[model samples]
Target: MTILENIRGPRDLKVLDEAELDELAEDIREFLIHAVAGTGGHLGPNLGVVELSIALHRVFDSPADRILWDTGHQSYVHKLLTGRQDFSKLRGKGGLSGYPSREESAHDVIENSHASTVLGWADGLAKAHQVLGRDDHVVAVIGDGALTGGMAWEALNNIAAAEDRPLTIVVNDNERSYAPTIGGLAGHLAALRTTDGYERLLAWGKDVLQHTPVIGQPLYGSLHGAKKGFKDTFAPQGMFEDLGLKYVGPVDGHDIAAVESALRRAKRFHGPVLVHCITEKGRGYRHAEQDEADRFHTVGRMAPRTCEPSEPSIGPSWTSVFGDEIAAIGAERPDVVAITAAMLHTVGLTKFAARFPDRVWDVGIAEQHAAVSAAGLATGGLHPVVAVYATFLNRAFDQLLMDVALHRCGVTFVLDRAGVTGVDGPSHNGMWDMSLLQVVPGLRIAAPRDADQLRAQLREAVEVTDAPTVLRFPKEAVGRPQPALDRVGGMDVLHRSDDAGVLLISVGALAPVCLQAAELLEGRGLGCTVVDPRWVKPVDEQLAPLAAAHRVVAVVEDNSRTGGVGSAVGQALRDAGVDVPLRTFGIPEQFLAHGKRGEVLADIGLTPVEIAGRISAALVRVRTKSREEYGR
Candidate 1:
């Protein structure tokens, strides 16, 4: 049997010899390449951390000693070591999640897939351990890219202040998060990687001074007193030392023995200690190493040998449409600029960056900084289009509200993966943007129904130079253009029935599904009028009058149903005194599991057949209530 086959848990790893551990690492990599190529997941990050993860499991006892992973995407190797190696339906419906899950195992602590949050969690856990008088240790494994976030520094400050706290911070320096890490911290880390240790400097002083004259003895005494200044001048290892935390070696992350030694040293230190380990992003795979864009950070189902996609491209994605349109906008408007939070290529800003190199800015993995900086740029007479994944925009909510909306800045937010990005699981699905942005005063949100609408609404969003405007789209391919038969104010009348009983309001990419549901309702002798409100935020003024003309009104969206466009339309009807029975259909207010987009939508009852059936039942109840009122 293979070394990996016999391993059931961390205890299995503890018993392995050096050769057996090396063989186990090879087996795990082979398993990952085959398993992930079939299912698709984070391949590069997990491949890079095989040795580090093995060393960590051997050195620390998890569940008792919390080993927290920042951004959780790098926990694949950890999962393998913890006896959860079943990768058959990984990231599929009722299968292993791409990230860590508390439901799956007791070893997984935090389930948050967002970056830069592990440090704060570690601080809190350590504090709790101290208060409860527990002897367990807290180890936080953070990536170099995650250090760019402001929250990491906040936690670092707190962790450093508590000199009595037992915390081991493992810095996994792969030198990239999505794209290459940016800003001052990245440069500082690069410098640290090339420098020698303080111990080497101390030894060099002893060797050189011992060969000198009688004055060497007197000079050594003065040098000992000024060792702090000497060390700062040569090594500059004072960055962590000044913060009151012990700093360990810049060890080779791939060398299991070296990493284990450093981890053991940090474990002995009672105070906060940091172990810096250097590793490559895609170490074992040649194809991943050749990928310069994102280092194959995330991959789709692919051929293991060639690294090519297993499936062909369906069509032009929503991002490509935005990419072409935004680049054209930059060519015409000299005042136009773009901002991304370390995701230039992911959010389709690459074309814009190529056209206007100086106009585009990558703010690292710091969404809050991206939002606040865009506000500053807007106030400085520039139109900045901040492009980010819809889910990540949640991190900058306070900045978007207080800095951009309150000041009435003309910052246009382009949200890619705006709704139900199913494959990456719940934390990645952009299902909350519409619901969360509802309370932001004067914020106009546009949910485009097709490629044409996405291009047009993007232009409209940039034209607004007073209040904040958001243009959001889903993660799938843009379908064939669905043209409107007519226009009603700001809404598009896709289909109209002679005996209009139900006014179906479609939001964003769900227009096609809404049209299908309308056809199903029409077959049942229920005439329906379908409209796509291109901009869904203010609940278009024309909708209240349209709802009054129909007996029942139904609104469908890909966002959460609680505070989505449907709820906004309901409120609009209430204010206008239109008492038509309304039904809101959308994703329920809960964390959706990982699956194919169609399957997850069907599971949540967002399919056309289910929607039509629900609407039909609601119509029956409404008619019965009307007859009862007449009888009364």
Candidate 2:
């Protein structure tokens, strides 16, 4: 059996010699490369942390000693060390989650796929340990890129507050979060990485000086006594030291022995300690290391040898469509600028950044700052499009509402991966944007049904210079363009029927599904009219009147049923005094499990057949009630 197979738990690692441990690390990497390539989860991030994860497990006892990961995509190595070696179905419906899950194992703590949240979790856990008078250790592993977030500093401020509390913070300085770590914190970490140790300098000086005459010994003694000042002058690690946390080495993260040594020292410290570990992001994989952008941060099913995708492309993804349209828009509108939260490529702002280099800003995992800064940019007489994943937009809702919407700033927010983003799990799903953004008074949302609508709606959104405008789209390929039969006010009439008994409202990518459902209803001897409400919010002026013409109205959205476009339609119909039976179809109010987008949708009854059956039942109930009332 291999060294890795012998290791079932952390206890198995303690008995291994240095050579055996090295073999184990190599075995782990080989397994990851093959397993993750087939399964299509985080490969580079996991490869980078093999040694670090091994060192952490060897130094600290996890489950008992809370080991937390900042963005839990890096926890694959951690998962393996804790007895979960199966990667056959990683990120699939019933398989291992992409991030930490509470249901997975006791070793997995928080499901922290969201970046820069581990420090806060660490602080609270440390406090709880202190309150309970427990000796259990708390170690939080956070990336240098995550440290660039404002919340990390906020948590650090609190972690520094308690001097007696023992907590270990390991800085996994891989230097990228989808892209290179940016802003002042990155520069500071770079300085720390390069700076020579003060202890080494002092020790060298002491050895040479003590060998010399009396004057040399006196001079060495004076410098050594004032070590705090001298150390600050020597190394740039004074940042964490000044924050009331004990500072440990800029150790080689790949060297298992070195990382273990630093972690041991941190564990022994009474107060909160920061252990700076320098490592490469894509450490064992040649292709991942050579990757200039994101270092293969996330990958799909691919051949590990050639690093090519296993399957062919479906077509232009929703992201690519947005990227092309936005780049074209940049040429027409010189006033338009783009902003991304350290994910220029992931959010499809790469072409825009490449074309208009100076006009774009990468805010570095700080979504809150991106929203507020967009407001600032708009006030400065420029229209800024803050593009980010819809799920991450939840972080900056306050900034979007108060800084942009309250002030009536003309900022366009482009939300990619807007709804039912499966595989990455519940936290990564962009299912909450429509529901959350509905309450923002001045914020108008556009859920485009196709590529043509996306382009048109994006241009329309940019044209508005009064308040915040949002253009949201899903993760996968853009479907075939659904041409409008006619236009009813602001809505696109996709399907029109005479003697229509049902009016179907389609939102965003679900237009195709709605059209299919309409066809099924028509076959059932129920005439159906399908309309795509391009702008979901503010409820198009003609929607209420249009709904009144049909016997029953059904609103289908890819977002939550509560407070979504359906809710807005229901409210609009009520206000217009249109007493019509309305049924809303959407994701249930619960955390959906990780799966394929189509699987998740079908599971939630968002398909055509399920929708048609439900609508038919609702229509029958309404007619039956009407007949009873007529008989009365």
Kindly report the root-mean-square deviation of model 1 from the true structure over all alpha carbons: 5.7
- Give the TM-scores of the predictions, in the order they appear: 0.92, 0.92
Q: Report the error of model 2 at residue 1, Å.
A: 2.6
Note the residue pairs that clash in candidate 2. none
lDDT of 2 at 162: 93
lDDT of 2 at 462: 99
Model 1 alpha-carbon miss at residue 23, Å: 1.3
For 286-350, candidate 1 gives per-residue lDDT tens digits of 88889887778999999999988998999999999999999999999999999999889989999
What TM-score does prediction 2 earn?
0.92
lDDT accuracy of residue 297 in candidate 1: 92
- Cα-based lDDT at residue 81, candidate 1: 92
RMSD of model 2, in Å?
Answer: 5.9
